[model samples]
Target: MYKPQLNMESLERCVKSLEENENNVRDEAQKALLNICRNVLRSPNDDKTREVRLDDEVVVEKLLPAIGAMECLFDVGYVEDGERLFLPGNVSLSRLQSLSKLLSAVSESKPVTKDIEENSTAQKAFFKKISKDFHNVMHYEDPDLQKKARSVIPIAQLEIAAMTKMRHLQKSYKFSDARKTTSSTQFETELTAKDLLLVELLHWFKHEFFEWVNSPKCSRCSTECVYESVVPSTNHRCSRIELHRCEKCNIIVEFPRYSHPEPLLTLRRGRCGEWANVFTLLCRSLGYDARFIYDETDHVWTEIWSASSKKWIHLDPCENVIDKPLMYEKGWKKKLTYVIAYSKDEVQDVTWRYTQDQEAIMKRRKICTEESLIQFLRSLTDQRQNSSNYSSARKNYVIMRSLLELADMLYIPNLQNKNSNEIYEGRTSGSLAWRLARGEIVQADIEKNYIWDVSKYGKMFELRYNIVKDIYHVVHNDGTILEQKSGWQEGTNITNGGIFRKVENDWKMVYLTRSPQAQYGCIKWIFEIANSELYLETFKLRTKSEVFHGARVSWKIEAIFSDDKVIVIPVSNCNNFYTEDVRKAVKLNIIVTLSGGQGQTAWQHAQVFRQSLENIEEASMIINIQLKNH
Candidate 1:
């Protein structure tokens, strides 16, 4: 297990800095962010509401320019998707709503009160306890642990140059067999050319480049060896040595479990750890950005960044597996928690990418609080991104790649490639008993036992209330009898709906007839802002001073279902009425369930449009919205 080696105080400082950036752009950024978050919290299941157009002038000018704002967004689960920012459905809506409330207060210039200060202090203490718990784990404080963890890639990079000199490996019979039998046709057809090349390399590496060593064979007698006792290793490459005895020859054999990749290149025989280490080095030697993924449950693998695919693809050299992220969890039924991927330029928590049961995994995550764990991981990544060893271009590339991987972990669906022959076969490299004892063998009907909660996975989202403060009641009043209404269709049944459009510096209302098959009418007002930021300062039905006829107006927020059905959102105070932002649009659709010359109509309705807004005597609403340069 890779324990987090981080200073809790430094982490606290980092978080405070992330939150305390006082850049002037922070205000507008938070306002824009608040709107975006409100929409997501309102209609979490609605995919359109979760996207932030990255290319839009508003996002480019207001959100992206503010680093603090972008950090806040990322913290709340917004990730990049090409030209847009997406909040994945896997994110907890309740958590997001809470964070948004804090952000809203920040945007409105509300000072943190004493209670809030006390709460923050308690949160810091909790995080400190988490950090302390991490240190309590055995070997967590071992100076060599973190050093070895960070040194894997740099050492692997150096091995790339030494690989050419490994004459013993080149001369081996296994190498010849691998070279002779290598075939690209065995791989999936959908693989890009670059991916195909990696597949070929993996095929060669698994079959010939490396060998799994359960126990050392007798050098004097060609016989299988049995594990004896552990012994200290004199070799610098291995921290510990295993003593084995030949069954037939009664001879002792020494098996050193090498930690470094240099000796593995020549020896070519070890367990998953050595195989992963060497294979990852080979990948880097071939000019691919590769990572060593360490699963806390005692397994190791390699992840290669495919430029063609633009994402990290899982590879298990020991099993000759390609892209079977869920095989361990689903096929072998391993209870996984932490699976961290480390490279020269990044450190990522990739546990989400491999599990089908996140709820279960989350329960098993007892090592630290999620917030502290994420902050620890981010701190590691920030160090790499701003490393003095990297060039400006390289730093930028690392930053971009980190963002891309973040998006993949949060947003991309982990649909394993079906073409992998061994996806469900489970451990093939080790002996049958070893596989069974380690619970690496795929059991009959094991996968069937793990049923995924659709609502908790994929593109699903939780239905939540809108963050709006209040919903003003619609009041009606009687007015003078209508003479002739402009833009009213005489033959049309105009009692149902009306469209509000800005025309010639004044807003015009066009009466729309309710479809004969429809139940009620809707009064819709759409405000579209192109390449600019928009904010709803106020949306209220103002009271009128004049006396008039009265009509009953019931205001109900409605949501469009996937089946195109309009279902009333049963929330009080207009908090259920979520504003939709689609392609730089803010639409307000008010559905009027009842209308007409029923004795219930009024004159004061002119202040706030009546149920029958089509009546020429009715007044319009004062929509106070601000659309300005981002």
Candidate 2:
């Protein structure tokens, strides 16, 4: 007999490694020990002869509840990663399975058209009320709210009915060989049956998310390109983009921006691939056992065996609806627009597609349409739109949990430094700017207020000799470095951050910093060589609103060398904070000075500046005195 270690120390090790285990070691240990044979409850498994050993009971008593506890915690979080949810060890699988069965029985007990547990008199009133409610709902101007409300209850009701039918059928089936059931035919068939129930659950979840999204009533951009998927309603400033679509309808959409996903599904490099990965993660996280299969034609889908609905469902997110062919067929209904082929490499793992299975798949497809997936909403509902949010739904709760864990384990220690000016891109703003001691320039002009001046584009100004060329460096979120080097394109421009075709320059640039928060935004540096001299400066503001803010402002005055890059050094005026060309220096402000140089062949320079200093660098530049907040 193996001695069981019941101490927290040993259990803690088990808990940690359970997540780290790739061989399903933790899961096997857990399942083998959890919920010692219970006669009071019925299991989806048909076999009832297995005996629970003493150690098995001990494992359940000691570790089962700990696992089940995760279900109650909607916000399961990673230890430094409060941005995501964490599944605890206390979720009771038995309890969940039981609830699923019960919910299913409710739907199957009496068809919606019929009500009342015992008497016809009660049925009459229930039907009458439902009829009246439906009529009133249609009269409302905003049908969405009522429509969602309508979707929620009916879905729940349908799930209950379907589950009840499934409970009866499941009693006759044996799943003892689940892990070892390698027969693709049998495994595929069973997998479909399980997915039916999972899809039913997703329907209600979809409706619930919309309730949260719409409750705040804010203006949303439904343009083909923009996505507004914020949650909790009132946090408007925090709203972010959910997904990005290219200009082609045929183009595939990418969500969450992860590397390509294959071996699970053969989706191409775009939207189809994204949807497959998102749906697969969500389904498994929700406790719905599913398998991803790809067809030779590259189609992917899942089958859910819903013991509650007494059927297996086919779910195809790409179709934007549930594929309910068999169930509708059983009812003698013709093929509706919602049905489609669900194949994995030109094969479907099912011997039969029952009515319950058909209905469950169709329902889930409707709920999990791309428009309603957590991947879409969470990707949008964050300050960065980087998939940082807590989804209350069952699927998202676990997926979020796993992501939180993965993020924590994979996070690089110096990650923030890598994102020095990354937030400007996170904002997905049309414009980007860089500010530094050199000067300011615009690679792409985004200010509608000054779009008319094509002159500001190609103007190149010479500030020093060593600042040879106008080029800068940028770092992406993935830690890749990008060098931004631009010059006068084919089109004729006066040249640089100055004016084109204009005889004189009209702006000056200065470097300024106010607070730590302000330091996080985008800043670009640009260098220009015009009239045999090199001009160095920065263009580092994502928007025009940040052009002027109080802080320290400085001009570059280092000695210029004939054949070297311009050495940049800060120069302060007697007033302690003033620019040579500036008349009035405002506190908490940023300035780019305009300088005109005489030359029939005039030139200008600019760049985007992004710098993240370490603690040592910060300490060296720290000012003792605290300044008033701007």
- Relative to the true structure, candidate 2 reaches a TM of 0.20
Badly placed stretches (over 4 Å) of model 1 are 1-191, 412-423, 443-630
What is candidate 2's CA lDDT for residue 41?
A: 32
**Per-prediction RMSD in angstroms?**
28.1, 27.1
lDDT of 1 by residue, 268-361 (tens): 7887888887777667655678878878665889898876667889999888888778878867667787787777666678998887678877
Give residue 591's lDDT in candidate 1 (0 to 100): 34
> TM-scores, in order shown?
0.41, 0.20
- For residue 628, model 2's alpha carbon misses the true position, in angstroms, by 40
- Judged by lDDT, which candidate is best? 1
List the lowest-lDDT window of 10 residues for candidate 1. Answer: 461-470
Give per-residue CA lDDT, model 2, range 1-630, as digits (tens).
011222222222223323333334434443433332232134433323222221122322332223322221111110100111211223233433333333233335522122112223323332343233222222222334334334323445655755765664454344545446455455446544345555554454333321111011112322233121211223322112223332323232322322222212222223333444435444544445443433211234455435443333465454333544232223222222122222111112131232223443342222123332334324323312232343346345445533543453244224433533431211111111111110111223222121111112233211110112222223333434332323212111112232221111012122222211122222222322222221222221221111222222233322233454334334333123322321111111122233322221111221212112121121111001111111
lDDT of all predictions: 0.51, 0.28
Question: Residue 47: error of model 2 in Å?
Answer: 44
